[model samples]
Target: MTTASSTSSESSQERYQHALMNTFGAPKLILTRGQGARVWDEDGKEYVDLLGGIAVNALGHGHPALVKAVAEQLSTLGHISNFFASGPQIQLAEKLISLLQPASGVGSRPAKVFFTNSGTEANEAAFKLTRRTGRTHLVAMKSSFHGRTMGALALTSKEAYRAPFEPLPGDVTFVEYGDAAALAAAVTDETAAIVVEPLQGEAGVVVPPADFLAKARAIADEHGALLWLDEVQTGMGRTGAWFAHTASGATPDIVTLAKGLGGGFPIGACIGLGDAADLLQRGNHGSTFAGNPPACAAALAVIATIETEGLLERATMVGEKLRDGLAADPRVTAVTGEGLLIGVVTTVDTAKIAAAALAQGFIVNNATPDRIRLAPPLVLTDEDVAAFLAAWPTILDAAEALA
Candidate 1:
C-alpha cells in the first residue's frame, strides 16, 4: 500500500523489479513529474529531458493545450469502439492527410488513414495492406527498426531481435542502408512494398543520401510496388518538418506514423496514398481502442500547438545550435540528423557518456556504443540548450575518464 506522497526512487525501483517485466531493464530515474523540457525524479532531482520520451513528446510534458484537449475529450466522450466515429477521430485523420500533402505546390494525392495505438501497430496494418498486392516480398533496409510486434519484427533487420523468433513472416530482403544500388537490386516486380525510414532513428539518427529516398520511389514505381516510409520517429516535427521524407521529394504510397503524433498520448497512423489508399478494405483490419476520442483530441492539440507556436522553425534553429556546439568538441567525430532529432558520434563509449549526462542533470541516450542521440522537445528553450552546451565539455571529459 504505497502512496504517491510517500514513495521514493529506491522504494519504487524495488517495487518495479518485482511487479513489472524486465523488457526495458532497470528504470533510469523513476521520474515523477515533468513540464516543458524538464522533469523531476522521485527524489526531486531536476533534469533537462533531451530524449523527449524517445521523440514522442512533441509539445513537451504537461503542455496546456495537450492537457486541456485530452481532459475535455475524455470527460465528454472517451473510448469508443471502431463501430462508431468521433469528431476528433475524423478531424485527426483529415489533418494527418493534409500534413502529408506535398510541399512542392503540386496537386496532392488521394490518401486514407487507419489509426492504431502505437507505431508498431501502424506498421502491422501497413504490412497487411502490402499483402493485399498479392506479392509477398518486402524490401527493407539493414539496421532498420519497425517495432517489436510479430509482423513489424519480421520487417525489422536486426538479427539479435529476430533470432529468438524464427520463422517470421517471410519474404523480406535486407539491403545496406543508404545504398541505392543495393536497393535497386533487392526490389523486383514481385516485391509488394519497399519500406524505409526517412531517418534511421534507432541506428543513431542515420540519414541516407539526399537522393536515396527518391531512388527508392523510382525503383518501387518501376516494379509497380508500393513505396512505404516508416516515419514513426521522424514525423510530427521531430526533424523540423511535418515529416522527414518531405526533404527528399519522394511521395511514398504508404506512410506509417506514431511516436510524436499524440504528443505522448499514444496514437499512430498508417496512411495509404493514391491507388494504395483503398488497399485495406472494411473487413481487412480493425482495432477497438484505436483513434479513441481522447487520443485524437490530444494529437489535434499537438498539431495545432506546433502550428501556432512556430515550433517547426524553433526545432530547426535550436537543432542547428546544438549540433554545431556538439560538433565543435574534439571528442565528437560527427554530428548527424536534422532539426531536434540529432546523433553525436563521439570518441568515448556512449554508455559512459549517457551515464555522465545523467549525473550532470541532463538526459540523453546512448543509441550505440559510439553514438549519442538527442531528440529534445520542440519547446526546448535557449536557456536549456545553453546549459547543456556549457556542460558538454565536462560530460565528455567524464565519459573519457570512464573509458
Candidate 2:
C-alpha cells in the first residue's frame, strides 16, 4: 500500500497522466476532502463545488445521514446476492415507485425497478428491456447523450461518440430534439421505444417546449412504442420535482435514474410502469452489486434527508436566484433550466469561463463551447450562491479577455 508520505512530493497531475487512461484527458485537481458544498484540494485550497460531482451529490459531500446509513448498513450486511432480498433494496424500490406519481400527485402507477450501478448501466438495462418488446427499432433525439455502454451508445445521437464505436446495436434512429413533429415522423409502429432525456443535461441543460414531452407520449402511444425518459441527470429532486417529466405532464412507460439517487454512492434503476413492467423476464438481467445494502441505504438516506431538509423547495428558490444572477451579466445570452441544474448561454468561450471560475476557487462545468452548466448541490447555501454571483462578472471578464 502506498502511504501519503510516499507520494506527497509528486504532483497528482503527473501521477494521473502516468497511471491512468487518457480517456478524460488530464486531471483537473487532486481533491483531498469535501464537506457540505465545499471541497479542499491536496494543497488545502478550498473551492465551492458548483458542479456537485456533475449533479450526483444531492445532499452535498459527506452528509451525516448518508454517511451513517452507508456505514451501518455495511456493518450489518454488505453484499447479499440478488437471489436473496434485502430490506434497504426493497424499501428503496418502493420509495422510487411512490415518487413516480403524476403531476396531479393523486396516486402512482404500479412500477417495477431493476437496479444497476450507474446512470449508464441503468440506461443499458432500459435498452435491453426495449429489445424484449419484440421491436428492434429505437428512436432517439439528436444532441442527446444516454451513456457510453454499447446499447446506450446506440441510443445516443452524437456522431463523435459513435464514430469509433461503430457496429453499435442496430436500428437506432436520431430525430431533432424538442421537435415534436420530427419525433412523431421518426417513431413508427416498428419502433420499440422512444428514449429521451427530460432535459438534455450534456447538451447544455437544454429543455424542450412545454408540450414536447406530452407530444412524444402521444406519438409513442400511436406507434405502440414505449416512452422511456432518461432521468439520470434530471431526477431525484434536481429539477425541484421527484422527476422532471412529472412537471411536463408526460407519464412515461419507463424511467432510467441515477446520479443523485444514491447521493454520492453509485446506484441506478430502470423503472418500468404498467405493462412495461413485465417486459423483462427473470433471467433477462441481473447485477451482482446493483442493490447491495450500502448503496440502497445511501439512497434511502438521501431521499429522507431531502424530505426532512426541504431541499426541493430550496432547490427551486436557489435556482431562481442563480439563474437571475447569471443572466444579469451581458456576457450571458440566455439561461435555462429548473432547480439546481442551470445552463448559462454565453457568447464567449465557455471553456475559458470554466478555467476562470476554477482559478477563482469555484468548480463548474463547460457542457459545450457556448454553454456553461451549473448543477450545484441541493444543500448549497444562500451564501454560496451569493459568492458565485459576486464573482460572476469578474469571471466572465477574464474569460472574455482570454477568448
Candidate 3:
C-alpha cells in the first residue's frame, strides 16, 4: 500500500477532527516521526521532506547538536521571563550583531535585537518600531507574504488574505515588486519604512533584479524611510549566505527573521541597525516567550552547526545540482532561486505535481498554480539530491497525465 494510504489507515482521523480546530484545514497526515530530511507517517512509511517544514527546519529533523542543545538548555533552565536575561540570550544577540554588520558604512555599527516567538511576531515588533519613527505611511511589495498579524498583514499585498482581516493597521501602500520605478514613486518624506523581501518566497521564489535592493535603499535614503527586509523566509543562510540582502550590500534599517533562525526551534528576531536601533524606546514592545533561554540556545546551536559543518557552501553546491537537474526536463519551463530554496515552473498545474510527488513519497509545496517550491534542509546530501532528481521526471509525467 502507498505511504499516504497506510498513514490514513493507521491514524484515527476522527480523533483529530474532534480535538483540533478547523483552521489549517484537515491534517495532511498523522506524522509519527522524523530524522534528518525525512519523516515517517504513523503507518511506518517514510518520505523525503523537501519543504523543510515550510523552510523552518534548517538542520532538518533531529540534528544531534540541536536536540542536545534544546534538551540541555531546557533541563538547565526551562523558561526565564524576559525580566531577567540569560547567557544564551546575550550570546545570540552578539552573534546576530556580528552577522548583521558584515560590511557596514562605518565598520559595522553597533546594533540591538528584539526577540519574538515567531516570524509574524518579529514582524509585528518591527512594524511597531516603524511607528516609533513618528510616521504612519509604510510601503510593501505585491505578492509578498509577511505574516498574519494585523500589523504585518497590513504590509502584505495579497487581497484574498487581507480582505478578511480588513481595516488592518492602515496607511500602507502596495507596489509592484522588482519594479524600481514604482518603488521610487511610492516613497515620500512621510513614509516610515519600505519593507521588502530579498527574494520573494511565497511568490514562487521570485528573485528581484540584483540592483533592485540597492534602488530601494537609495529611495529609502532619499525619503528618510527605514529600509526593512523581511528575512523571515529568506534569511539565516537559506540563500547560501547569512542574509539575502548581504550580497546586495544594502544595509537595511530593519531586518526581521525567523524560519531557519532557530533551525526549527521557534525563535524570531527584529534587528535594527544604526539610528534605527534606538527608535523603539522602552515599553515599545514585549513578548513573554521572546528571549527565553531555551529558544536562544537552540538558535545558537543552529548557527554553530551551520558554521562547523560548512552547510552554507554545501547548500550552494547541492542547490546548483538540483536547479540544473530540474531544468533539464522539457516539462519544466523554468527554474529560479539559489541554495535549497527553489521554485520550478511548468505548463501543468503545480497542485497536480505536488499531489503526484506525495503519492510517490516526496513532499513539496504548490506555491502557485504553475509553480512548485522546494526548500529542503541545508543538510541535504548529494545522495538526497540524486534521489530527488531521479524521481523528478516520473513526478512530472504523472502530473502531466493527471492534468
Scored by CA lDDT, what does every candidate get? 0.93, 0.92, 0.90
TM-score of candidate 1 versus the correct structure, residues matched by position:
0.97
How do the predictions measure up, each by TM-score? 0.97, 0.97, 0.97
Local accuracy of candidate 2 as per-residue lDDT tens digits, 95-214: 888888554142656789999999999999999999888999999999999999999999888889999999998699898899999898898999999999989999999999999999
Cα lDDT over the full model 2 = 0.92
Candidate 3 clashing pairs, residues 3+ apart or interchain = none
Give the per-residue lDDT digits (tens) of candidate 3, residues 255-351: 9999999998889999999898999888879988898998999999999999999998988898899999999999889999988899998887899
Where does model 2 exceed 4 Å of error? Answer: 1-10, 103-108
| Candidate closer to the true structure by TM-score (higher is better), 1 or 2 | 1
Q: After superposition, how far is residue 291 of candidate 2 from its true place, in Å?
A: 0.5
Residue 42 miss distance in model 2 (angstroms): 0.9
